[model samples]
Target chain A: MGRTWTLIRRRLLQAIPVILIVSIGIFGLLELAGGDAVDAYLAVTGGGDPAFAERLRQQWGLDAGLWVRFLAYVESLVTLDFGWSVVMSKPVSVAILERLPNTALMMGAAIAFSACLGTLLGGIAALRKGTAADAGITVGALVLNAMPSFWIGLIAIVVFAVKLAWFPLGGIASFDRPDLAIGRVLDVAWHLVLPVTVLGLAYMALYVRLMRSAMIETAASDWVRAARARGLPRLRIVRRHMARPALLPVVTMLGLQAGNLLGGSVVVETVFAIPGLGSLAYDAVSQRDLPLIAGILLVGTLMVIVVNLLVDITYARLDPRVTDDRVRAGGA
Target chain B: MLKVRDLAIRFAGRSASEAGTLAVDGIDLDLDRAQVLALIGESGSGKSATMLALAGLLPKSAKTTGSVLLDDRSILHLDEREKSTVRGRRIGMIFQDPGGSLNPVLTVGDQIDEVVRTHRRLDRRAARAETVSLLSRVGIGDPAARARAYPHQLSGGLKQRVAIAAALAAQPTVILADEPTTALDATVQAQILDLLVNLVQVEHVALLLVTHDLAVAAAVADRIAVMYAGKIVERRGPEQLVTDPGHPYSRALGQAALPFVAAGDGRHAALPELPGRMAEAGGTACAFAPRCPLAIDRCRAQVPPVVPFGDGEAACFRAGETAQ
Candidate 1:
């Protein structure tokens, strides 16, 4: 337990510099894009007086030097207060927290659905290599992977939402009731169907291919032959010997893909019109809400870091041969 | 005791025009308990295939025709489950490359303990204790510490010892060692062979030792079967096979063994070497006739049946003449 903690701590520390650089670079790009809280405030508030905008800019420290503004941003981050969003007129942290749960809910569902379907299909395909089932799955995965996520989402909405009238095309929940109960949750889920399916299919296709390749490679290894020669039952060989090592590479790939998924969710969320972080970030970009955009970028960066860290810990647990020092060192 | 009769294996050819190639022809072998029988042959001589068939570990694609009897039960007819029950529980196998045979992720102790846990209903603690004891039995030092070490952490010789320990964990009645010492250094090979012989002797287990080296077979085998082109051409006591070979292939192997000695000594003339490679025998009269220097008109026209010599068998029409 102590060793694992040490490993996690070491990994967390190493990620700090990477996250710092990423955040700074994102903040710098947002600044260079010629946007400010004063402009967003004037636009959202329907053109306030010039003096009011100037006072607001000075109050938010937006009228300071770049380094001073960066230092203030870091200080606010350390204080767990990401300043106020000029467009939403709410604390950036509150806005992020409010929207984060929705994104989390969608991502969680997609991951769960994809992992189960992908692993099962991958295992079957690998076990029946060169068979019809394998060929069908390989072709299906190629098609799914090659298709654009937004296009898939739009097509699903057209078929299931507009044409079939089975689901709502936009928004997270039915606008009539906004309570956080089981019925409302189900309604939200109903609306998330197209987006989640699009994201899940895109992600699961790659996982299946990865798992199939890894399993095929592992099956050809000598240890698998040794396991067979030991006279173990076939299922036991697949479950105990072949599956674990094969899944190791899959786990690593899944972790990296999860990070990519968070980034790619922007397109899917916008297409589905779901009020998740991806849609929120897209709205901020269109309105040029600097504070909100920076906050979203920070949140996305943090999500990547946290997910990767969790994956590293999971990897260490699954395969003890992967030492903490190596994971902390990071990347080939 | 174990016996294999009329064993044959045919592999499908890549092209439709070519007939299925016979990897092992009608070969027969018998080994008594507490004795080692060495299957000696070159790479393509069907020695390993015959052993795999006898062990019931042959791939599903290959066609096998034979009766492999372990004591009284015919193993060839058994289903996969029954074959597995007979394999590690009653018949243990040691593969050629010890490094490749052992799992890299597992500790040596866990690997051996797995064998015990598979065949026996021992608890984890009891299985682990037995694993350490088996490790010590295989002559590994610091058995407790060694049990926790993975295969990559150990040397090649140590890994082989771990393999032997795992094989012995089941207390099998028959152990098939396929070139067990081929990958080890000279001194380690000697030690591993000594450990194998001592363990087999003490446990009264039948050993089917397979090797291409005549000298290695001579070192540990009680009876030697020289295989040529998927058939056992000759079977005799180790001393008789080495000193008075009957079949032409056995004679060639024996002469090849002589070159291992220092080359410059004038006191003894160099041994005669066989000419040409062993050609792939098709559906022909005799497999070795193409490579035999003394092949006559009759030798090419007819296959030789197993003829009894002193206390062994030789499949040659002119065994006595060949010996001369």
Candidate 2:
């Protein structure tokens, strides 16, 4: 437990610098792109007076040099204040927080769904290695990975929503739900079925393949062989001996694919009509809303850091060697 | 007691007629309670294969035939469930590569406790108690604390001790130790081997120690079986096997290994070397004939029959001949 805490502390400290660098990078890149909310607003109006545009830019501090504006943005961020969203006419934080639950619910369910099912199928493939079952799983996972996320989402929506009419076309929920808490929860869950399936399928194949290869490699280790020699039952060996080590790679991939999952959401959320970070970022980018995009990037980057920290914590818990003083000292 | 009769194993996935598939082709061995039988051979010589067969630890692709009798019951013919019950309970295992031979994530105590809980009908607390005691018996100091330590925390010697402790957790009737001390330092190696020998004597368990070093085999094993080209070429009492090897390959192995044991001075003579590669398995000729210094025209044409030599057996037509 002490070791776990130490790891968490170290990882948290490491994430601080990364977060700052990413903020600076996003700020610089957006600055270099030569646009702001004022330009976007002027475009909507078909034209504007030069003084009026200058005043609008001055109000938002976009007229200031890069360093001055960046320092102000950083100051506000330090106090948890994301700048105002000109497009939404609200604080960027408020607008993002409003839709966060929907996205969180969808992403959480997708990760859980893919990880659980992928681990199960992968274990089966390893146990049935060199057989028809293994080959089918290996190839099927490859095929799933090969297809684009949008394609999978489209097909899922068509089959489950358009044809079967089992789920809604797309959205967070329907209007007909009872006012009861469980009813609202169930309604949201019901609406989430297609989106989660589509999102989960996008990464499930990669998870399956990673997990399959990790388990096969783990099963080949001398310890696994020693477990069998100890006369442990086959299932016991697979579950207790092989599974934990095999899970390390899967967890690592989950962290590695965090960016990909966020990228995947751009398509899945748009198709499902869920106003998550992906759609939020897409709108922010197109409308040239710098503060809102910065807020979204902050959230996305933080999420990746959190995911990696979780991976580190898990590695420490799963593998005791990770906590050794030499390893902790970064002695390779 | 363990009695193996005409034990033959062929690797799975490879066809029966495929070359290199028959890893152990028709070998017989015997070990009684409290005796150690060392199966010594070079790499690819089927000693490890023989150990795997005894424990029923071979992979699904390994096709084992013939009968391996433990007491009176046939081990080879047992179903998977029965094999599990008999293994770990009746026969413990100590593998080579002490560092990697134990589960890396698990604490040493947990590894042993699992075997105890599996083989014996013990509760978790009782099994844990047994684990600590087993560790002490394997010569680990501060056994209680050591039990909680993971494999990575321990030195190579201590890891091997933990492995030995795990093997002894279930009070097995037989132990299959495959080069158990190969990875340890010389001093630590001696201690591990001593502990293994002490276990066989104190616990009255039959032990089969597999290694490639004939000197190590001769040091502790009551009897040494010299394997060559996937077959046992000679089995003799250690003293006789070392000083007067019956088979030509055993003699070569003895020559290669004897310098460390016999030569008192630091400077050593050049060791005699075997001349040729091992023959492929599916032939009607002696596997060692090509490498045998005493090989004759007849040796390459026929499989040498097993003949009594110095109270043991050797499968060589000119087993004792000194020169070509």
Candidate 3:
């Protein structure tokens, strides 16, 4: 546990500079871009007057030089005060925070769905290696892995929503029952089903392949052979001896896949009308919402860094060899 | 007591064009309590294959035909469930690579205690106590403290001792050690071998030590069986087998062994080498005929049988003819 804390402290210290650099990079790129949010605001107000544009630029502090604006952006981030959204007229953090829970719920369900089902199927395939069952799973997982997530999402909406009428085609919930608490929850869950399945299936195939290969390799290892020779029950050998080590690579992939899943959610959210970070970022980019986009990028970068740190710590926990390496390196 | 009769094994090939390869062909062995039989052979000579057959640890592709009798009951015909019940309870197995044999994530105590709990009706606390005692029995100093360490934390020799401790936890009637010290240092190998010999004497357990080194086999084995191309070509008491090898291959192996020198004379000794590769199994009537120095016309056409000697048997036509 002490080692875990030390690792986390070191990782956090390392990540601080990376996060700052990412923030600076995003801020500078957005600042130097061709489009201006003040120009868009003036266009929305149906006026191209020079006085209104100047007033808007000064109000948002866009008149400042690059270094000054970049410092202000870092300062606001440190204070947890994301600047106002020119498009939404609310704090950038508030706009983002409102949509975060929806995206979290969707991605969480997707990851959980994929991980559990993939591991189970992958284990079965490993146990039945070189059999018809193994071939079936291998081919099926490969086929699913090759399909794009948005295409699957669109097809799922058509089949389950348009044809079967079992689920809604779009939006977070049914607007007709907005005030019904239980109904709204059910409606939200129903809307999430297709999107979750699409995202989960895309990742599920990769997980299945990773887990299956890991299991096969681990099962063929001498330790597993020794476990079998110990006369341990077959299930015990599979679970206690083989599963933990096999799942190590899967856990590592999960951390890497988190960032990718966020990117994937944008496509799925656009098709399904879910107002999550993906859709928010898409809108912010199109409408030139610099503060909002910066806020989203900064938060997303931090999340990925933290998740990666957690994965490393989990690796140390799962394989003591990793911990030993750290100890040999003077508790790095 | 354990007896294996005409034990033959063939591993099924991947494709139809390739026939199943015989790995252990028609071998017989017998052992009583409080004796160690070392099955000595080079790589792919069926020594380890024979041991795996006795333990029923071969894969599904391996077709093992013959009988393994443990105290009069036929263990070969048992189902997987019954076989597993008999495995750790009646026969314990020690592997060559001790570091890889133990689970990396588990503590040494947990691993050994699992074997105890599997064979005996004991609570967690009782199992831990038994594991610690077993570790001490294997001569690990500070057994309690060492029990908490993982496989990675211990040295290779210490890991082998932990493996030995786990094997001993079941109180098996027979212990099958497959090159148990092959991965350890020379000094550590000697210590582990001594520990095994002492355990066999103290507990009255039959031990089957499979090794490729003739020296290792001669050191602790009361009886040694030399295997060539999936068959046991000779079986004799260790002293006689080392000094007066019966089969031509056994004589060749003897000449090939590093000669023991009393003092500085060891500096310039040249070891003799066997000249040819081992014949493929089941392809020749006598697998060793192609490599044997005394291969007569009949040696290539006929399979040799184990003929009786003073107290053992040697599977060679020229074995009795040579009076040396």
lDDT of 3 at A284: 87
Model 2 agreement with the true structure over A1-332: per-residue lDDT tens digits: 76677777777878899999999999889988887888889888797999999998888778888778879989988998998998888999998998777877888788889888888889899889999999998788778878887888889889989999899989888867679999999999998999898888768887788788888898999999888888887878999788888888888788888778888888899988888888988889888998899999999888888878887787778878777862468433
Model 3 pairs whose backbones collide:
none
Task: For model 3 chain A, give the 10-residue run with minimal summed lDDT.
Answer: A323-332
Task: Give a tens-digit lDDT track for model 3, residues A72-170.
Answer: 888998998988987778999899999888888898898888888898889889889999998998888778778887788888988999999999898
Q: What TM-score would candidate 3 get against the native? A: 0.93
iRMSD values, candidates in order: 1.8, 0.9, 1.1
CAPRI category for model 2: medium
DockQ values, each candidate:
0.49, 0.78, 0.69
Tens digits of per-residue lDDT, candidate 1, A73-135, equal 788767767787766779888888989988988887887777778888898899999999999
B257-281 per-residue lDDT for model 2 (tens digits): 8865545576686776778687766
Clashing residue pairs, backbone N/CA/C < 3 A, model 2: B12-B61
Those runs of model 1 whose alpha carbons end farther than 4 Å from true positions after fitting are A31-81, A158-195, A324-332, B15-17, B123-126, B141-145, B255-258, B262-275, B283-285, B293-298, B309-311, B317-324
Error of 3 at B101 (Å): 1.0
Ranking by TM-score: 2, 3, 1
At residue A109, give the lDDT of candidate 1. 81
